[model samples]
Target: MAGLFGSATLGIGGGTLSDLFRAQYRGKAVAIYSWSPILAPLVGAVLGGFISQNTTWRWTFYASSLLSIVIQLSGLIFLEVTYPPLLLRRKKARQAKATGADDLYTEYDHLDEGRVQVLSTNLFRPFKLLATQPIIQILALYNAYFYGNIYILYANYIDLWTNVYGEFIEIAGLNYIAIAIGSSIAAECCTLINYAIFRKLSSRNGGTGVPEFRVPIMLPATLFFK
Candidate 1:
């Protein structure tokens, strides 16, 4: 359930950033946003092992709960409604209240009664793309393979280091630093390459972005991985 909620939050956050950012910066912003998930487990395993060994396993839950509370509070305090339709609807309501008129309505408020069906379709649209979109299918396949191996390694690292190397659990955890370092370097390199490709492609397209602009770089990168 925790992983499910966390993944859902990440998906929603990515969607929100897509809406919030301009086309040119969206790729870079998303790259940076996505770095956390790749990097966190590498860092967390070391720290979590250290804490669990020195203190108690319960502290992990406490720490996670505290961190969640802090983030939730910060979001509640610092974030504002960024969706344009929602903001406009709120403004319309305020205006109506002040002017004593019921006529004010945002475009969303005027949407058809069948909008519930439209919303349901929108919710299922991602699943539809997952099933049918070849590009999405390919990328999802690669991501699943890559992260699956990383997580498999994450789970078994302790056994590998402990039984094989006769290292303490905390010391065994230090092996995760190698994964963290490699991930950081790859992320930085990808960010730079992505930025360079996006700029060049945007210029070549006369400043209008084409989704295909991002594909060329990936081909070489994937081949290099091969």
Candidate 2:
């Protein structure tokens, strides 16, 4: 999970969006990317409920494991490196290989920045940030609560519907329809409203943007969060 869609993918996606798109297109790109995390689990829960009901409950883990393996394998086969530092290092490597001299280097690959140093930095940076940055700590805590409740809800959702409502397992998955609809609407609102608010704020501030402009968008999110 960490290697695939957890912190690693979140970090990569944020960087990849900045690297791949201009500022004008970044918000829209980010909207789609951000919406994906919600969509995946909602879809997964519906499918998993049906799978568990007809087959053994253990099949849920097997199915998810298989899907994860397929996603990872596909990434290995088809994912392109969008990170500029990594891409630059690859180009430098190819050039050094062509010539006899193997002394090619970039600022990111300096003599002081060995593989061990880079690996350690990446491994511990999140923890360091979480400890040192108040904003990061708050965000981490909020997300812990947010996603923790969400996963717990999804985990118990099927049992709740089947037992309390006395619904058949096959149709119990249908209960998620309202959640799925609401989430879809929220995703669309995020894309449209965020972009509109940003543009409006930028215009109001003598054609410049302020971090304060982003705060209003968070107001709605915070109100709806719990």
Candidate 3:
């Protein structure tokens, strides 16, 4: 259930960062944001191993639920509305209530053209990109393969160690820590490198930045070597 919702809305955080940050800093901000979802599962697996070995499997879920509650509470208290369209809509709503005006609207209100249109647009967007953009299709396929490998590893990793290598389950899970550490270091490097390259490219284009400027750094990073 968590995986279903997480995968469905994974793009929302990136979209939110795009709304909050300027173009020059947006890529770097999103890189930092992207690291969390990728790191969480890896780190969780390591913790799950120790918890499962010492306690029951149910305790692993209990720990997860407790941590999720903490995170949601923190977000409720500290997270502010950052998306401009949504912020404007919220402001308009408050003004309408206070002024007794039912006709108040925001610039983005045109987008609320019934639930059906909005749902269709959102649902078809990825397919539209895949249809029109060859690069997007290639990237999608590549990521599909890459994540497939990671999922397979997660399923068989402890079994391989505990059965073949005769390692304790707690020790077997420690291997995921190495992957988590490596990915963290890489994300930091990529964020800095991506920002630096974006700055240099934007400067060359008569002080105007193009989205294409992001592609060079992105391509190498896609290869996971940058």
Residue 142 shift from truth in candidate 3, angstroms: 1.7
Model-by-model lDDT, in order? 0.81, 0.79, 0.83
How large is the C-alpha RMSD of every model relative to the true structure?
Answer: 2.9, 3.1, 3.1
Q: What is the TM-score of each candidate against the true structure?
A: 0.82, 0.83, 0.80
Candidate 3 accuracy as lDDT: 0.83
Model 2 poorest 10 in a row by lDDT: 1-10
Candidate 1 whole-model C-alpha lDDT, 0 to 1: 0.81
Q: Estimate candidate 2's alpha-carbon lDDT, on a 0 to 1 scale.
A: 0.79
lDDT of 2 by residue, 47-119 (tens): 8778988999999889988988998999999988887787888889888889967777888765446789889
Which structure among the candidates has the greatest TM-score?
2
Residue pairs with colliding backbones in model 2 are none
Candidate 3 lDDT, 1-226, residue by residue in tens: 9876667547777777878888877877777786897689888999999999999999999999999899889978997878787788889989998999998888888766667887899899988999999989988997787788878877787788899999999999988878788878887887788777888999999877887776676666656632
- Deviation from native of the Cα of residue 152 in model 3, angstroms: 3.0
Q: Rank candidates by TM-score, best first.
A: 2, 1, 3
Worst 10 residues of 3 by lDDT: 217-226
Better of 1 and 3 by TM-score: 1
**Clashing residue pairs in candidate 1, if any?**
none
